[model samples]
Target: MPHSQDTTPIVLTIAGSDSGGGAGIQADIKAISATGSYACSVITAITSQNTHGVSAIHPVPLEHIESQLDAVFSDLNIVAVKIGMLADADIIQLVARKLRQYTPKFLVIDPVMVATSGDLLLQQSAISTLKQELIPMADLLTPNLPEGAALVGKPVPQSEEEMGALIADLRALGAHSVLLKGGHLEQDANSNDLLIQPHSSELLRAKRHPTVNTHGTGCTLSSAIASYLAQGNRLHKAVYLGKQYISQAIAHADELSVGGGHGPVHHFFNGHVNVR
Candidate 1:
């Protein structure tokens, strides 16, 4: 569908499709729409995915992705862009170039690499393209602990302070601001997230209840942040409110069971009834 608006902030998601509807563009679209922003989409790839794992991946041709972007950019009041999975380096480069040419007000990236099922969705070479081309364009970049470790060429951090320093390092590397997700970090009982910017002393912190059904949390977060930013929240405030939304999302995850292993978070946790 082409991008359309009706006095709502229009947010676009450029990402892959999850057949299981837990992660990637599916989660992004739901999250953005739930946050009261109109959603426009440009899919980068399609994955034969399930709750257990990724069975296969078919990349959308670079030109096809570009055409989708063109369809949206030509006629929408696009306020923000959230990037998720780009299947390869070439696609990454193309997306980076197009985004630079048609700059949106807010550019938020969720650097999706390894899936919750332990499958690597991004190529080894594509990491370089992501770092070199994409991160520089982002107003905010969100990466999980494993992604952070890989991007910085270091071990997964054990301390919040270490994560803070790593966030700073990644900001220096490219992202104007960074949210280093602490999902993989184990602390007492709270799930934590740390947000910081280059040379900044202030640390933005958020917490959520620990839950088993936590799939799509990252995608949900980046999309939520983008939606909030599109609606005129400052970056840090957007992140903060996004955190609250995800916390409730996690807390209410078990209201509906969608999968056997690593079920999806309840995007309709705000009491919206599922129609289908």
Candidate 2:
């Protein structure tokens, strides 16, 4: 069988490798392609991980990282970029430098600090470099509750007013826009996410699904947003559509049994007429 040579917007993911095929660069590529963008990748770090947890990490050398970025930006007409886990200060600095050089039209930064299994992905010392350099370059910052709190140097809020305040504080850190994910906020019947732009704010509401197969929700959402942006959708609209896509993914994650703990969402759920 052969595939069609269709022309689609290119989206580059500069992120870490997930041996589990569930998160990091793996999830970014899946979400980007599933949302209609051609996906390219630059591996930042390789992690020994799976459904249970991450055991070890090996950061790619700075020279290799630079080479990969040059290779992609030189040839592909990249419409957008999605960045995930960069394990250390050196890697973060390297990524920030490359981003400044290429300057893609849209950049979605997912500050991947902690993995779903409560393992630390980013080094503590790299937080400063990430905040000072990479975050300000992002057109959109997608951080879950804990990551958002870490970014703002505050505790996770327990109320809507508190969440709104957090968004403002994060935007003050220089990101053009912020999607403060509320999924980690005491789970209830519904999940609420906040999107803050320069002059407006929106609280996106969706029904929360009960499942443990949410290993890569943040990566998926941010990559989907980048894909939508590459397809020419506006920021707010892209965020909304990305939310809808992730909700359905989480809702239907039970259809597959890939691993023993915290399995991945079924990224190909919409590829068929009947997903049974």
Pick the lDDT winner. Answer: 2
lDDT tens digits, residues 1-276, model 1? 543464579999999999999999999999998988889999999999877889999999988999999999999989999999998999999999999889998999999999988899999999988999999888999999889888988888887767766755676668788888887865635567777666564545455566678878899999999999999999889999998898888888888778788888888887776734
**Could you list the CA RMSD of all candidates, in the order they appear?**
2.6, 2.3
lDDT of 2 by residue, 9-101 (tens): 889998898899888899888898888889999999999999999999998999999999999999888889999999999999988988888
What candidate 2 gets wrong by more than 4 Å, as runs, is 1-7, 272-276
Compared with the true structure, model 1 gives a TM-score of 0.94
Residue range with the least summed lDDT across 10 consecutive positions in model 1 = 199-208
| Candidate 1 clashing pairs, residues 3+ apart or interchain | none
> What lDDT does the true structure give each of the candidates?
0.87, 0.90
Candidate 1 has an lDDT of 0.87
Clashes of 2: 0
